[model samples]
Target: MALIFLYIHVLCLWLCSSTYNAQNVFFQPSFLVTRGPSVTALLYGNSSNIILILQTTSPSNVTGSFDPPSCVPEETRWVLTSELIAKTTVQVKLRLNRSLRLCGNNETDTDCCVNPLCVRETLQVSACEGNNSQASLIVQVKVYARLVSGNMVFDNKTIIQNQVYRPLGECPCDLTFKTCDLWCCCDEDCSTEDFQLFKYHCLPGPFGGQFPDPEYQCSVQSSQNSPDWFPFLCVISPPGNNPYLGLFYQGNKIAPKPGMSFGASVSSPPTLLDAYIEGSPILTLKDQYFTIPRTLNGYCVTSAPVAFLKNFDVKCVTPLQACPTEPPLQTIPEDLRAVVKNGVGGNAVVDVTDQLATELNDFITSSESFGSSAVVCENVPLALDYNFYWKENGISGITLTRTLGTVTLNGNVSLTTRYSAKFLSGDITSKPNSGNPGYQVGRPVIGGILNTSIGNDSLLIERSPMHLWKPVNCGLCSHADVRPVLFGENSTSGCLLPVSQLNLTQCGLLRDTVNSLQDGLVEASLVAINGHPNAVTMADWLNISYVTLNSSGVGDSNSSCSNIPAHLQIYVWTLVTGFVDEIPQKDIKAVEISYSLSSWKLECGGGDPVCIDPAETQRLPVTSSVTFIDIPLNTGPPKNRYQINFTEYDCNRNDICWPELAFPFTRFYTGEPYSQALAKGIILVFFFIVASVLGTPWRQIRQIWSTI
Candidate 1:
């Protein structure tokens, strides 16, 4: 017999979870200039009123003939802050949907517009502060566009990489015109000779533009072989060296000028589209657009926007510097606006309930606050729920609410915000069904225990118990949050339970509690048919795992309780059917449950009679998971079926013969029938016999036969 020993160790460390660029921001302008003046502007404040200051040096000659600068709105004034020898400073306050007025008395409109203010404006020092001392000092203000001529620009903002767009080249590596550049094979001026000499050593363009060669491989090993290999020559190899580089050329072959805006012209709020795109922002009823806050790759984004007819629930952790006084809809300007004015009458106003404000205030102030020394005061959002009623035309009404946790001073708050959006029909205002005839993908799965002990024919279904698993004191598991198992989603949740003094009495109580939590699912008698609980039949259940507990005796000094239930895993198998123009229907087919058990034992040390730290309590982790597996619906049977017998070849005379039936030779059989194969074999044999007999001499053939 052989003996084996195993050792296991566990370590847990609580660290302050922090991430970079958690908020979703559009157009992170990071300007880089090689040989030109550059200006940097920082915006500070909320969305209603944002202040931006620009300071740059002005050239003395201001009378250069150039395109006219864009006009600035009346509400936004560019005030001259300071005027020095050749430098000037100006400030402007920007607001959303502000009106604009005509500036000059000329009948021809130069800068004024019937629409909103232009994003690009050129303010003169004289016009801003009536200081005409420097005529050439015109301040060019460009928003969401490049402000300087540069070869490269790097922005660390969260950009949706899934968008389909043509890249406008800002850097041209081919500096020389009509001339061959050394090691620049992409240069159009380079001839075949120049290309051949520099092809192996071609350098990548600054903005990742390369020659359009679809078959080119940038790998070192691939370059070291034939076709790409240059014998006995060192070649430079860079990753992703392919023809389809990041370069996107314009049809006109003209490079965009500096300070050119690539984004769409924003004159007013965008109109509603037939269907909203995923990750694209929701339409703004007024000046504010609704953003679904979420975290991507561990960083929080304020605008993982909602897609029309697509339901979602996103939960993420974001760090807040201070506790918020107002609701998230008001504090975070990205939320959908609640109040709007009636366009008919200027004074007529449409009122909305302050549900978010009231809910958030109660959530924050109602929670228990801790002292500075006892509790760490880092703030994170608790939850933000959005319910929108939309019709065929557009969104009809919206209801928003927010919940915040404890707030502390000078403490970093780690909060988790769960944001969910469900769009209901404007006419149908009742609780939305999981599905019309089948279960929806994101909706909660319906499951419960059916009780028939009440009467002979009476049956009652009890809702499944849910364990609270909220984050407490920055811990991974807690006992405050409530969540459900959503359909088509596989998720695991657990809570920590502290057990003190694992004795027979305590173990018995734990056993009873776990059994109650199991809810007799292990011995379920029936199953729902097509996700319809009322329509059920005798279930053909398969037991994945059975819960069991074994103990030697009550208060047995040498024995301990083993096989206590510690985990429960639920497996739901659903049959998914496709529809031509409707949402996919998911119907429940089967369900399986598995239970895992744990044991309680103490370790003795130093030859002590009792266990070490026997009085200390242990935090045992209890977890449960629900996994959904989609089974493709069987679409009838095949048009033709193969034979059951392996030995018999039963293919039709017109059809191709079975390849495996060529038994003696286990090779692929040609499409030809056996008769044609035999005829070809006989003809080849006859020709070979004739050739051998005519080509070979009799004496040589006899000698070959004798040797064989």
Candidate 2:
């Protein structure tokens, strides 16, 4: 490239002066970026140099005359004309000096500039500098396309475009402007590699920045007002309700598990989590906290705070691609969700998980009461303990959902409590201070609300803080409505939706979804305790009072002014399908399985998550996705097929779903093997028909249906 430049510089300098008979230097038809259909310009130059600027404004053509330097004062007249050949390509023509003939404009043109009489000059277009979209705005005429020319010098072996001619233009709404050029940056592209915002892509433009946020504007254009189209579909929803991103399970807020931690992982050994976290469980809620791991529609928010207050407030992450946002949030793997069952695992974070262990102790004591000798969950803490006595067998599940597409996973974890802590029942007030009853209940904090004012679709989830309880105070939270609004937190007169008690509902749901594995916790803990087989029926279960979204009530100091939106009427129910494995042989662990039907976000990391453009309520009659998740913890993904279903307001579409069954019933020829069999059968039938018509094989007609 450097050598090319050297050659160009030498050739161009030689062409300008070598005693040319025509005394002419004209750039060949060059590719120029013209804002409008036409361009005109004037020229002035001496024998030593020539200054010419091509432009588009009013009159048809631009003509001018300049004298020769170090020679005659009376000069040559040059005409410049321009035309737009393509959207961004242009052709400029220069007509000059017919009288000052280089070789007298005849065959005997020996007085050429460099070597031979024939010279082909060419100029290449470099790049776009700038253009104007508004006529009223007085902006400096900027340089749009640059022109670089090189001569096909007779003796020079290489032709290099070394000379650069850049013309600065003033662009307005159209060609009527005094100087400005009119152009549009509708190329359907912007390099987000540097930043999501592109200056030419209407970012901080002359018009007020139409982009609410870089993630919104730069993402797939989803609104009418949001530039007609964009490079990709975007899913920057408001912070979703807690970790599941406001997704509910089996028609109720999933009871937060006592000590389960959740995160995302894609690598093998599966132990290396992408973004894992655990939080305090509100009171005794079984699965209320963010326990089950599943791919969120957008990006992952830090489990640090569960929800967001407003759009203006800074967010650590968004719902979709977790880019272009402030204070980086953990990048939760969107492909697989990992729930370390024993309790949120001991992976980096400690404060939240420790508190949950205490709360779990409180819950077990309340349930067992210690009156009878059979103490079930009395001494168990979800954390790592030498005497915890937790064991994990092999577990696995396959998710048939939109986001993950289709993922299958299998693993085993074991957690056992080594020590038992004694506690008195009904001593809540004695243990903690007054005014706040369950305030000390290890509860996960939910931040950021979900907004769905725009782009509400069947497969697209638009989460907003507005959906949550709004705070009484904007700046500081004096009172805020936190997630898991418990059974009696909302008054009949104050908040619209009253908290619904789901204690029995929680245990029952678990029983229905997790009992397929004969060796899992449900069996070991009840049906077969300590190698003793005992039939524990549903009748033996106790009616437990688990907190819903109304967790921790509201902070005592902030209780008086709880953010009503965060604390009030927002609700979501989901159907999750996955597998659970419990292996206590070597290590103690709990396996969790879950899956979603539709994408919570428009884009699911891939180019498109849908076969057809998702309609608000329009239903796709027959498109199926088979998701596969590969997880090898040294332990392979379980062979059993499992799934779960949950739903709420699914765009009023038919909530039709296929139940997640627990068997490899489809392990046969349902796929390619079936297709091959089908083809062979068709060929056989065709041959039989031909044979029958031709006069043979009639004996085998009825026998084919029976057997060989």
Model 1 whole-model lDDT (C-alpha atoms): 0.46
Candidate 1 collision pairs: 22-300, 24-302, 62-136, 213-243, 378-412, 378-413, 379-413, 380-415
Which one wins on TM-score? 1
* Candidate 2 Cα outliers beyond 4 Å, as residue runs: 1-21, 27-50, 54-524, 527-708
> lDDT tens digits, residues 1-708, model 1?
122222211111112112112311111122222211233322211212222223333334677543332223233334333222221222222222321332223445443432222345543322221221111234465432111112223232223222134343322545544444456545565556446544677676443335433333333335446463444453444443443344443323444456879998779865533344333445444634545676667776776655555677777654554544554422443433444221111211212223222123222322334553334333334666767665554455566655534444334444556777776765333334456567777766554456666776655554342222333432323332446557777887666655545442366666666555544323343334333344223342222333334422344333354555667777788876555356666677766666676775544467654444455545666667788787867775643444533424544432556754553244244556666776776788799988878775866988899999
**TM-scores of all models?**
0.37, 0.13
Estimate, for each residue in 1-708, the C-alpha lDDT of model 2 and write its tens digit. Answer: 999999999998787656343433332322233332123322111212332342222212445321111211222233444554544333444443222212222344433322212222221211111231110101112121211112213233222221222111111121221111112122222122212223354323322212233344344354665654444554455422213222211122234445655876446655522222222221112333422211234433333221111011111211221112221111123321333223223311111112223122211112222333431222222221111111132111112111111111112112211211111212222211111211111221111112335454422111111111222222122222323222112211111211112211233332222122111111111110111111222222112121232222233231021212221121211111232342221110211222111111122235442323332211111111111122324543543432113333222344542331311223334545755666776788799888786664555665685686
Clashes of each: 8, 119
Deviation of model 2 at 190, angstroms: 38
